[model samples]
Target: MTADATKRLCDVVLDETIGRATPDVEHERAVAIFDLLEENSFAPVGHDKGPYKLALSLVDSKLVFSITGEKGEPVATHILSLTPFRRIVKDYFMICESYYEAIRSSSPSQIEAIDMGRRGVHNEGSQTLKDRLEGKIDIDFDTARRLFTLVCVLHWRG
Candidate 1:
């Protein structure tokens, strides 16, 4: 069977319960959603679904993916424990802080170095997300990366 290129996310929603995000976090979430909707390959394993809508949230320390059809019908709901991602997320945030600081006071080379480290940590988190969703959802690396951004947004306390 050929892979359906149409199997992608058409829309993304973050649970309101996550609370109001800070300006930076809101910007990140918006960008992630835009990038994700612009181009993504999200296919649910064992289920033929295309152009899905994803509603992401965190409940009881579990990350929830509440997927839906184009018409708002239920598709699939996958819950993943946040245990494996805690350390990586923490690292990513710390590196991001350094990168932001470098942008303000450091030289170009220093900023570049910090950005590289930030990307590396981001990739690790994305890979972990892909691994966690292995059997449930089949998403390409870029999609996973964008989704990881959303995951981090949900974890944002400020």
Candidate 2:
């Protein structure tokens, strides 16, 4: 994505309808997700032996973030380990971006786009995604946004 696209994505996510609805609630959620993302608590591939560390790396070429595990890890183990958690993060960002993109490309305000996106997530089986993630990881929507923000901020600008 271009820098403009990235900024627009961020704006939609941070908009009042979806993101600014309840700052405190979002903050709490974001913190919870961040904790889960940074920890070694979740199974890498749903194994009892795992306490695999989770990491996020931005792929500008793909315009999406990669949810990865420790280096040299088995792909199956990594996939099994972090699949649910990764889905949550990926979906969250995509939802936000989709909203932003729709709004930017249309005549709607950014907030309207966010609302539409949020509704889409809710109506389009975000709960199913949540069900897959629940009990597997301790996180919520807000934390996912915060984690995304942190990743964007920490990424190299040049």
lDDT values of the candidates? 0.85, 0.39
Q: Report the number of backbone clashes for model 2.
A: 6
Worst 10-residue stretch by lDDT in candidate 1? 1-10
**10 residues in a row with least lDDT, candidate 2:** 6-15
Error of model 1, residue 134, in angstroms:
0.1
What C-alpha RMSD separates each model from the true structure?
2.5, 14.3
- Tens-digit lDDT track for model 2 on 22-104? 55555654554454344322332243322233433223222232222343243221112233344444565567667767766
Give the poorly placed runs of model 2, Cα more than 4 Å off: 1-52, 55-105, 109-115, 122-126, 144-158
The local distance difference test score of model 2 is 0.39
Tens-digit lDDT string for candidate 1 (52-145): 8889877888878899888888989999999999999999989989998889999999999999999999999999999999999998898899
Model 1 ranges with Cα > 4 A deviation: 1-5
lDDT score, candidate 2, position 30: 57
